[model samples]
Target chain A: MNNTLKKNDMKTAYIMLLPIVGLLTVFVVIPLLYAIFVSFYQWSFYQDSIFVGFSNYLLVLKDQAFYKAMWTGIKFALIVIPIQFVAAFLFAHLIKNLTAKVGGFVKTSIYIPHVISGVVASIVFMFIYNYNGGLANYIVSLFGSEPIPFLADVKYALGSISLPAIWLGFGFTTLIILAGINDIPDSYYEAAEIDGANTFHKMIFITLPLLKNVFLYVIVVGLTGAIQQFDLAYVMTNGGPLNSTMTPNLFIYTHFKNDPYMGYTISAALLLFVIIGVISALMFRLINSKQVED
Target chain B: MKKPKFLAFMLTVLFIISSILTGCSGTGPAGTEEEKPDDSSDSGKTVLNFWTPQWGDADKEWWEKNIEAYNKSQDKVEVKLEIVPGDAWDQKVVAAQAAGTSPDITTMNYNKIIFSAEQGKILPLDEYTDPAIWDDLYENIAEFVTLDGKHYAYPMLAEPSAVLFYRKDMFKEAGLDPEKAPVTWDELIEYGKKLKKGNVFGLAAAGNAAEYGWTHWGFQAMVGQQPISEDWSEATIVNEPTKELITFWNEMYQSGILPKQPLGGYTDIKPLAEGQVAMQINGSWAIGQLRNDYPDLLDNIGVAVVPTNDGNQDKPTASLGGWTLTIDGNSKHPKESAEFIQWLLAGDEQIMVDFFKDVTKFSKFTARKSVDEVLAQDSEGANDPWRKLIAEEVVPYAVAEPIYAWEVSMAYATALERVMLEGTDLEKSLQTAEKEINDYIKNNNYAGTNPKK
Candidate 1:
């Protein structure tokens, strides 16, 4: 009787898992595989696709635009990761310092941007960055600086694109880091105070060491999220001022439009994917080794 | 334990049922209607799907009114209209085509008509459409949409892609003739300096990448040269005409006549109407927008052809950029869709006239000459209120927009931009464009593939 009951329980669990597994196979797994398959073919919309083995890959490798797009992604990531981490850390500390009611209000308000759609955020920022009458120029003029066309110029464009995205994403990271901060025992800080440790010393000795896994999570997740950012960049600038801010996704998108071939775009996308994947895997390993060390 | 098992079993069944119901509910009322039998008349109507891009207020209203009128006017066919927003237009249309759920009919830009024809995305109208309807189109309009001697799209409206719009009040303030527009490129810069005041910019041309690239084609027309050869074989930007064109625009920018950064894109007349700029080079559609949104400023606005190097009114100063209605190649009701396009775009002269009336502009507007006659007699165009002046002066001179790959056009635009904004050397900038175009042509094996040829 006991054995029969266990079998029934296992059956129910498997049934619950079925939908998710099916969804993964259909949406995620199939597209990835197909993208790989199409990366070997050369043709556009309705034209007979020629099976050009490895040529598409070689072409994408040699393509200047592909390299430029990848470099832009890397540059964007470099700007985003450090700023996102620092802002989240400071914000989490500030929230921790505040009273519960005030903290809740502040936290929710900061998170309102995150809850809003990326496209909406981008549109709002477009107005804010407008050269003539935008809030950014308005404030800059007050400091006796010439008004800048923030999104419209290459020099300021990538940096301008990063600001709104960072503002949108940092709230979630702040909340996560805050939770990690809360998990640390108050007794540790109390003991540190008793042991002739100053506030900075306690932070260094107690807080930093304890939030190791959380910090790692933030960096890896933030790095990956920053690089894959499409909606905001695509919406804000449409990868313009002469494709200076063209993300890898937007590059692939424009290429597909010009010539709607599955092969070249897929090849470029796959190569980008491999590049991003390797970095992610390396980061994952770092996280695991850190976990082991901890 | 047996009771627990029973509850779990019920839960799984409930979940599956809910999922199915959710999927069904997503389609709402429109789903069932769309799934109706194709062209069989089993339901007493052949359901034809028509997709249009998101247009301006009046443009959207025109569709809403006409599609309803067409559907109600006939019981044999029902046309469903979907307005795809401008930004998402490309992606949505492509996906629909790929999925074989493409609309029976849709609107397309003239530039992509050839590419669309080559890909078999659009069907040839020569077979399904009336020959009289083909004869109704102007020679240029007919020639523009033809690929290998077959029409793929039927034009809806043709707007001269560049027209000089100026502020009469500002012109007076600068002690220039309030009625006269700059006729020569040199005169334009001269007037621009006088027009520049403390806060107002002298001119506003396209500074953004997308708008600048397209608007530059009109400048190419003004220069009396198509930047790419008609054969699509080589770059033509290194010549004297293009040299004069780029140099004039660059000098205008470097001299602080035009804004360092444009206040708005060329399609948008907001900056000109708001008095941010004394003059702006925009399309004929600006007249409609100006009349609709800034009625107070309409009286102060002056219209003229885009100025050229020698101010020769005979040369083409503008390229025709317009939309065309087309049938999907895979459409089950190609004949029906063609009939609908004919009925709307070419059928009743009054209905087509109403389109120009709704926008408040009709200067050589319609591809159909019959509609032009009706518009001249019946509808008062945008603001100019003059008939046949644009038709005579601008329309005849305005050449058909080039059908070369967009990469070539945008490459030349890049050259002009680098020279203007970054102050790159003229020869170097042209060299860059030539290299880019040559590379694209070589890679695509694009020699002599000009369908327009």
Candidate 2:
């Protein structure tokens, strides 16, 4: 009678899984398989795509612009991830200690930037960074320093492009980290305080270790988002000032939109996807394994 | 309990029905008709879709007035103008064509018309149009729209090559004569050096790679190098004159006369409008933008022909940039569409109203010589010196960018960008461009197939 009940439960479980599986097959699996298939051809909207084995991959590997873009993306991710993580954690911790009303106001104020569209943020940044009339230049002028070409110069282009992303993204990251911080039991902090632990000690032991899962989640997701960054870069630099700020996603888009090499673009996209997937998996594995020990 | 459950179910059904009714009714007000009237019922009445990227407020007002006039005069065809945004319009039209549901007619950039023709998306209107009409176009304007001995579009406007727009006040402050602005590459450098100082650039030569800075304004204006050969077999001009042009611009870069390299502020005409940049090499299209956005700059601004090489005393070559109207091959009403296009391009008062006053300023010369004459007569001594320069000097020297296969042209633009932005070895960049283009042609079986020749 128990065996019969188990079989019935298995049938019900399979039935319940059907909708999700169907959705996954339709949206994700089919498109992914189609993209892989299309990657072998020289595609254009105007003409038939001719199959050309691994040529697309070879071209992408050899392309100097692609190399530059990849390096830029890596630098962007490295700079933004740690800065964002620390800033978000600090802000969230600060908010956690604040009075409820004041904390709410501060949170809402920070989160406002997160709600602004990428295009809007980029345009606003453009004004703030404009060479002569911009606010940044005005501030610098007050300090007796010469006006800087923030977007125009190659040296500053990457940092300028990344600024808007950091501004827009950090707020949301802070909110997520705040949610995780709130989940921590108050008793842990109280116990640490009673033991004569300092604030830093409390943060290092009570806050960091307890919020490990959320930290892992934020870092992994943030890195992935940085890798696929497009809209802000597209709107602002347009992969310009000598393509110093170009990313792989921008490279793929240029291929798809400007050059009609959709096949090669898809191949590049798939390569980026694999890189992101592997990194995310490795990160999740490391974090979960560490959790197992804890 | 049973009665309550039944009542709950009844309420749920009522909610769904009301939601559905709301959705259906939301598509329109309660009583408006859903379908357009049949065109066949009225013999002389035709409905045409005219698509353009210049659907700005002024453009729309002009279109409505001219379309109204056309509808009133002929009683033949009623034209509806749909303004697609510039950035996505080309892609949108391409998708529409691929799906075989394109609008009756649309305007396309002259550089892009060849690609559309090559794809068989646009009809070659040679057989349908009167040969006499071809004579009305400026010599190169018609040539641009012609592919394989067939005209694919009705030429609308022609943006002549680059001209020098300078701040008269800045010129005065720099102790340089506004009327004696640089007329040669050497003189431009000299003048630029003299004018360079705080919060000002001597010139704003496009350094934005994506804008084809080197190819359009830099090389074309410097030594009159065309982007591709007439036969479209190879890129012919990336040699000495091109190298010289790049080197000249590099000199300007080193001089700190041009805006700091990898040019920003190309889109912000306000800097120039506010007298921050003394001189900028740009198209006539900027004239309207300046007039609209910086009215104060008008009194202090001067326009002149692009400077020539020291020895090439001939007219400086202007890059022709403008749109051409074409009927989509997939158009449901090809005959009517072609007729509408012809009417729009007609040498009548309607063309003047539609092309000049209603639309912004003529970014370029109107395609029709008659229209050009009318514009010149209308604006004779109108205090706009830039208009005078465009009318008398810029229009006559205008040359269109070479037409290659779409992919090849795109590669050329990319190569130009690399040369200007990265300071990449010009020869190496050109070689890479040539190889990529040839490979594309070979792979696509486009070799020896100059569709636009």
Candidate 3:
């Protein structure tokens, strides 16, 4: 009778899982497999596709544009991730110490950007960065300096574009980190304080060590988000000014539209996926190992 | 009691699931019926999906009104207009095509006509379209959508190539002829120098290669010639004319005659209107924008054809930028779609007038020569100086950018960016563009403008 009940429970669990499993199979698994399959062929939706047997991969590996885009993506992530980490941690800690009503106001204000669409945020930033009669140039004029081409100059375009991403990201990251901080038991901080720990010492000894998992989550997620950046580059610079702001995703998207480059586009996408996967794995391992050592 | 309660709960869950499963409330492509009110054909009207690149709210309302009119005009067909956002339209259409769910009729850029046709994405409308209608369309504009003596798409509006719009007041102040715009490239530079003063630029030449008008139309004026071979098989980026074009742009930048930042998109005429720029080159769309937003500046604005390098004032130099309505080859209702296209673009003169004058407020020019005549006779356009100038000087000279693989123009845009932004040598940049374009053409085996067998 117990075995029959166990079987029945198993059946119910499987039934419960069916809808999500089916959705994943249809949306994720099928598309991924199809992309992998298409990567091996010279495909254009308009024209007949031919089996090219990994030539697309070979082409992507050799293409200079591919490397340039990948490096830009990597540089973007490197700049964004650390900024997000420090800002989120500091803001969350400060907010956690505030009075409840004030904290709520601060949290909501900080979280507002998270809800703004990337395209909308980028457009707002575009006005700020405009070369002719932009807010940035107006400020520079006050200092008696010539106007800086924020979107036009290759040197400054990437950073100018990054501002929007950072604005949108830090808020969300802070909220997550804040939640993680709140989940930590008050007893640990109390004990640290009793042991003659000051606020900074209590944060360092009690809060930081305990928020390891959250840190891992934020950093890994932030890195991936930065790497897949598209909307900002699409709206603002359009991977222009000598392709300084071209991310891998932008490269993939541009090529994807060109039709004849379908094979190359898919191959590049898969390669980016693999690269992201490897980097994320390394990050996870490093973070987990650090936690163990602590 | 617990068993009974559990049984009741399960029965309720089953009832809800059954209702969801067996209910015919929501059916047939989740968004099809709702997002489009007149989508399904249950009312005995054949529904045709029409997709357009999204425009301003005003344009959207105008389109909906027209679609409704078309629907009500006859019970035989219901044309549903879906306005897709401009930046995302191409991707959305291509994805829909791949998924076998493309709209019956769609709007495409004039440059995309040849490539899309070659891809079999658009149907050749020669059979469905009336010859007289094609004849009525502006001849120069017609050249864009027609390939090998066959028209692939219906030309909707003609945004004539770059016209040198200058502040008449600024010109008068600078002792330059406000009546005659620059007659040559050198004259424009000279004029720019005269106009440049403290906190004001002579010209709003975009230094950064961003918009099509910034590079393509500017090159068209500078080269005073076509940069592509007649066959469209080779890019002439390394040719003398192209080099001269690049040199002119670089010199403009070096002289500080142009704005420090790239003027960006075609609609970027704010500098000119704000009096920061004395001269700017843009499409006729600016005529309406300035009239609406800056009525004070409207009287001061002077529109003239972009001058050529050789001082050939009469040479056809305007680069035509516009949209075309093409019937999707995958469409099941080709007849109905063609009828709708005809009604909107060709059949009704009143509708055409409404689109160009009433709706867009003369923001866009009609592609139809017949409609141009009607507009000229009408009060709204009769005394309009910009209208008269565009109809006579601009529309006649407008040339379509070489409609090769979409990548060719993009490669040119990139080359222009390198030359303008990075201060790269013109020769090297053009050579890079040439090599990249040739490689793309050969590698893709695109039959770009080859003689028909």
- What's model 2's interface RMSD, roughly to a tenth of an angstrom? 11.3
A1-294, model 2: which lDDT tens digit per residue? 697787668667755765665566556765586678667776544455578888888777766666777777878888788888889988997998899999999999999998899899999998888776689889989999977878877778888888888888998999999999999999998998999999899988988888888888898889888877888788788877667778889877776665534666778888888878998888788787476446
Number of the top DockQ candidate: 3
Candidate 1 per-residue lDDT, tens place, A156-253, comes to 88999999888888899899899999999999999988888999998898898889789878887787777777887888877877778888988888
**Per-prediction TM-score to the true structure, in the order listed:** 0.90, 0.83, 0.85
Candidate 2, residues B19-59, lDDT tens digits: the string is: 55334432211111222233333566567777788535666
Query: Which pairs of residues collide in candidate 3?
Result: none
- CAPRI grade of model 1: acceptable
Residue B133, candidate 2: Cα error in Å is 2.8
Docking band of candidate 3: acceptable
lDDT of 3 by residue, B21-46 (tens): 43434222121222323446788888
Residue pairs with colliding backbones in model 2 are B44-B76, B161-B318, B161-B319
Q: Give the 10-residue window scoring lowest on summed lDDT in candidate 1 chain B.
A: B27-36
Q: Which is superior by lDDT, 1 or 3? A: 1
For residue B290, give model 2's deviation from the true position in Å.
Answer: 3.4
Q: Candidate 3 — what's its lDDT?
A: 0.77
Q: Which ten residues in a row have the lowest lDDT in candidate 2 chain B?
A: B27-36
Give the per-residue lDDT of model 1 (tens digit) for B364-395: 38888887766556534423343355667777
If both were scored by DockQ, which would come out higher, candidate 2 or candidate 3? 3
DockQ comparisons of all candidates to the true complex? 0.26, 0.19, 0.33
